[model samples]
Structure formats: structure tokens, C-alpha cells
Target: MVLPGVYAPQEDTALLAGALSDESLPPGAAVLDVGTGSGALALAAAARGALVTAVDMSWRAVWGARLNAARSGLRVRVRHGNLFTPVHGETFDLVLANPPYVPAPLGGRRPRGAARAWDAGHDGRMVLDRICREAPALLRPGGVLLLVHSALSDPGLTVGCLREAGLKAAVIRRRRIAFGPVVRGRERWLRQRGLLAPADNEEELVVVRAELPV
Candidate 1:
């Protein structure tokens, strides 16, 4: 389906796919999809019979997800708002997010178009941090939070953040992807922030699954 304004899904979507456990998802589950860029994960969950509420800060993204759902003949509620604003007081069995995770430059300038779609804040964890902070309240007891982001952003820190928020967190999957030279500046910024090391071996996508205590 041609989702309006969403040119493509993120490469990390593949990592998210591995993190999702179809069996762990309750039948007819209610799902909250945060940062529904292209609505890929949200659509997948809905297709599996979960009732989905997909939220995106971008109006284009919201309309795109709704278009995609219509073309797929699926029922998904698309909301335009940052994080969980549109779904206040609503809880779900699953909260999935593939947030903007690229660290911005020192001057705070960002790239245009699709590249802007993925640029997180300085440490590459701005949106991720917010999601981890907000997810606990949005999930029901025993519900799962699936997050896909870069290993360059300190996977340990991400896991720790989730745990501190009272969830059981673990790295469910990791996948390496070739880094293009275009992102070297970003790599350097991450290194300087101590989020990534100069000697880091490779670029990788990390999928973390955190579950609320039952």
C-alpha cells in the first residue's frame, strides 16, 4: 500500500520484527504504537488481530499510517501528537516504538527529508528516553514494550533506564548493518558523548524488550 508522505520504513524495522513475539502477544490485544513513522510495526500487530492505536508527531506520518491501514483493509487508529498525548489514560497490552535515534550535530542542525525522520537529540536517545519514561504508565500489567534503536546510543544505558522505570528489560536481538560514510560525523558526536567508543567494532541495531512486572 502507498502510505501518503511516508516514503519508507526505517532499516531498524527489521530488528523490531525479531523482537516481537507473536505468541507473547495476547489474542485480540490492544496495542499502542508510539512514533508510527510508516506504521510498519503497528500494521503488523493489527494484522495479527491486535487493536492498534498508532501515534506520530508528524501529521504526514499520521495520515500516511491511516492511508496504509485503509489500503490494507485493516482497522488502526492513527493519532497526531507527540508520544502519548493523544492516548492519555489509555493502556495497552503492547507498546512498540522505533523512535528518532540519530544524534544531532553540535550546532543542532539537522538533515532534510528522510534523514530528519531519524535524527534524535544529542545523545541519540532523546525520543527513546521519553518512551522508556512514559511506557510504564501506558502498558497494562505484564504488557511488553518493544524498542528498536542504535547500539551507538549505549544499549546498557537504555536497558538501565527501563529497569529504573520498573520494567524487566533485556536485549532480545541485535543485528549489524553497514555504516555509510555519511554518518561519520554522527559517530564522532556519539563517541565524544561517551555513548559510543572510538574503537567500536561496528554499527548495529539493538532491539530491547521490556515487560512490566506482572
Candidate 2:
């Protein structure tokens, strides 16, 4: 069950899960799920025979994930920490992330409370950039990272950053979803910034896959 402040499973979650399902996981592959709010992706990986570890900055999210894992009878090591900190000095065969990518107004104070789940600062790359910078070091040779975010966050930049970091990255999945409450709420700001057209009622979500070389 999702805790009151935890991010619930939505299209982005399903998109990442679909990518995980398509991957050919080796026997007992080690998988890391960053920002694992409700532990859905961690549980999914565990159900597929993976040794999964999930981390979240929010204690509520960590507890909720553990609860969900227990209820599902899945063995996922859920920890409370930001991004990759909880899994430091370790590597995984696969890493999954569905970080906050919604662009909040410029110069706004950093998100607090539940807003932390989605109100990314400025260009919405606050969390995404950190993940790109740190994820490669946590991947075993040939390990893959699956990340999902809105096109508004600039997927091309993500690919470029990963490439510069020595990983082959590209957008492997795309889905156009109707504007959610967050986007709708920021309609004027987004349009002023040209992130959305006045008539645009939908946003395209993209899943980027980056792979480490052997």
C-alpha cells in the first residue's frame, strides 16, 4: 500500500516496468531501484528472480515500499536514502529510476513534502542530472539503466550526459499521456517557457536506456 506522502504507481511506473519486463535478466540478477516510492519496481524485479534493493530519500516511502514488499512476499531490501547512497560501493546488473521530472517555476524554493515526488526545479533535470552522473559507477559491466521522464525534461540531454559518462544511451520508449494535475496546474508557466503549447493538453513521456560497456 502507498503511504500518504509516497508516490503512487502511475504511467511512468508502468512504462519503466514494461522496459524491465522486456530485458533479459540473468539468473538472480542484481537490480537496484532508485527512488523506489511504493516498491512496485523493486517487487517486480524480485518477482522475476532478481535480487532487488530499493532506496528512497523519504522515510515514508521507504516504509511503504517495505510494507508492499512484505505483502507481496517479495524479498526487496528497501532503504531510506537519496538516490544511490544506500547502495554505495556496490554494483548491480540493472538499475531502475523514475525520478521527479516535472518542471516547477524558476527560482521557486525546492520542493517539500509530497511535492518532492514531482516538482523538479527549473528545467526538471535536478534529480535526473544527479542520476546520470552517478548511475554509471553503480552498474556492472553490460549492466543497463532504465529511466523514465517527461520529454519536457529533455531526453536528448540525458542521452548526451550518459554518453559522455561512457554509456550508450538512447530513448527506447515513448508514450503521450494527457496532462496530469501537475502539468495542468502549471499550464501558464509552462506555456510562457515554451515547454507547452497553448493548445497542448498532453505530454510525451520517454524512457531512456543506458548501458555500461564491458
Candidate 3:
């Protein structure tokens, strides 16, 4: 779909597919799609008959999502805000997110454009942490939270954080993607900075699901 002023890329499509393929999702659910870059997940959920509210930080993204939703004949409420700010005090039956998971380098300039889209904070869990922390407050009783992120960001840490937040988190899906090139680049930078160990050459994209306590 044409996303107006925003750029469409393969990664966004992959993320959408990963999120929409979750079998745990209930039909006719009220869903919230956080960081809805191009509204892909939101549109897909809407197509499944779910009432979808999509949130994005970029005004461009919001407009693009709306355009795509209209073109796809899917009903989605697109809002512009950071994380859950736009939906404060609102709750949903399901929440899905494909947050930025790449950790930024130590003392270096951030990459531009779509690359900037994927960089999380230093440990790559900045957005993830906030999402997990706020999720319990935004989910209905027995509601589901689905998140797709990189294993490079420390999946165990993510799961632990979610659990600490009182959510029952479990890995429901995982796929290893080749990242030899990424590893090479990161390794070079790390070595130059006197850091030890080679970077992980492969990244595991995982889908984590959590259910609110009944």
C-alpha cells in the first residue's frame, strides 16, 4: 500500500505478517496497534473484524496509515503520539507492537531515515520496557499483548521485565534471520572501541504474548 509521505520497506511487511499470523488472537477483538508505522498490523487486524486503534509518533505515519486503511477498506483509528500517550485511560482486548529493537552504538551518531526507525535505545529495550510497563494498565481483564522484537535485545531481559510488571510472558514464535553483514559491521565498531567479543551474526525475531491476570 502507498503510505503517502512515508517510505514502504520489506521489514514493515515482515513485521505485519509476523503479528497478524498469531493464532492466539481472538476474533472481533478490540485491538491496539502501537507504533503503527504504516498501519499494516492495524489494517490486518481490522480486516479480521477487530476494532483497531493504531498509534504512531509521526504525523506522517498517522496520515499514511489512514490513507492505507481507506484504500484497504479497513476501519482503523490512527492517532499521532508517543507510545500510548494518545490512548491514555483506554483499554483494549488485544495490543500488538513491532517496536524498534536495534540498540544504538555507544557515543556515535544515529543512522538516518528508515534505519533510524529501527534503533531503540542503548540496550534496544527502551521502547519495549515502556510498552511492557504500561501494558497492564491498558489491557482489559484476560486481555492479550503481542509484541514482535529482536532477540539481540536480550529476550530473557524482555520476558523478565514483563513478568516483573505482573504479566505472564511467553515466547510464542521465533525465527532466525541471517545477519552476517550486520555482525561484521558491529564487530568492527566494537573492536575499535576496545570492546570484547564478536557480535551475534544472527538475529531471532520473536513474538511474545502475555495475558492480563483474570
Candidate 4:
């Protein structure tokens, strides 16, 4: 069950799960799910016979993921830490991330409570940029990283960052979905930033796949 203050599974979660299914993993492959709110993606990977580890900065999210893994009878090592800190020095065959990508208004205090799940700083790259910089180190040779985020966050820049890190990266999938409560709440700010057109009612989510060279 999803504990209070944990991010619940939604369109982005389902989309990431679908991408995970398309991957061909060996038996007992190692998988890492970053920001594993409610353990949805982690559990999905575990169900596919992967040895999954999930990390979140929120204590509530860590517990929620652990509880969901237990209820699902899935073996997932859930840890509490910001981003990749808990998994330092560990490499995986696959890494999955559905990080906070909403563009929050500038000059506000760091997000708290449920808002922490999506209130990314202005431009939405606060966490995404860190993932690009650090994720490659967590992948073994030929390992894959699958990341999902809104087009508003600039998927092109994500691809560029991964490629600059010596990985082959590209957008593997795209889905147009209506703005969620979070994005809708920031509609005016987003439009002012040219991230959203006034006539647009939907945002596109893109799945980026980056692969490390052998």
C-alpha cells in the first residue's frame, strides 16, 4: 500500500514499467530503480526475476516501497537516501528512474510533504541533471539506463548529457498525456517560461534510453 506522502503509481510509472518490459534481461539481472516511490517500478523489475534495489530520499517513501515489496512477495532492497547515494560503488545491469520533473515556481523553499514528489525547481533540471551526471557510473558495461520525464524538461538536453558522458542515448518512447494536478497548478508559470503553449492542454512524456559501451 502507498503510505501517506509517498508518490503513487500513475501514468509515468506505467510508462516506465512498459519500457522495462521491452528490455531483455538475463536471469537474476541486477536492476536499480531510483526515486522508487511506492516501489512500483522496483516491484515490476523484481517480478521479472531481477534482483532489484530501490532508493528514495524520503523516509516515508522508503518504508512505503518496503511495505509494497513485502505485500507483493517481491524481493527488493529499498533504501533511504538522496538519489544514488545509497547505491554508491554498486553497478547494475539496468537502471530505471522516474524523478521529479515538474517546474515549480522560483524562489520557494524546498518542497516538502507530498509536493516533494514533483516540485522540481524552476526548469525541472534540478534532479534530472544530477541523474545524468551520476547514473553512468552505476551501470556496468553494456548496461542500460531508462529514464522518464516530461518534454517540458527538455528531453533533448537529457540525450545530450548522456551522450557527453560517453553513452549512446536517445529518446526511445513518447506519450502525450494531459497535465496532472501538479503541472496544471503551474500552468501559468510554465507558459511564461515557454515550456507550455497557452493552447496546449497536454504534455508529452519521453522515455530516454542510454547504454554504456562494452
**lDDT: which candidate is best?**
2
Error of 3 at 88 (Å): 0.2
Q: How accurate is candidate 3 locally (lDDT)?
A: 0.76
Give per-model CA RMSD: 2.6, 0.9, 3.2, 1.0
Q: How many clashes (backbone atoms < 3 Å, residues ≥3 apart in a chain or on different chains) does model 3 have?
A: 0
Residue by residue across 151-206, what tens digits does model 4's lDDT show? 99999999999999999999998999988888878888889989998799999999
Estimate, for each residue in 1-214, the C-alpha lDDT of model 2 and write its tens digit: 9989899999999999999999999769999999899999999999989999999999999999999998998899988887898889999999999999999985968899999999889999999999999999999999999999999999999999999999999999999999899999998999999999778889999999999999
For residues 1-214, what per-residue lDDT tens digits would candidate 3 score against the true structure?
5454453544434754675676456667889998888887788789888889999877788888999899888899999988999999999999888877766684455545555457676677778888878988988988878888777677787788888878898887778777544444675653454332355555567888888898
Worst 10 residues of 3 by lDDT: 190-199
lDDT of each: 0.80, 0.94, 0.76, 0.92
Which one wins by TM-score: 1 or 4?
4
Candidate with the greatest TM-score versus the true structure: 2
Can you give the TM-score per candidate against the true fold? 0.87, 0.98, 0.84, 0.97
Clashing pairs in 1: none
lDDT of 2 at 213: 93
**Which model, 3 or 4, shows the larger TM-score?**
4
Give one clash count per candidate, in the order shown: 0, 0, 0, 0
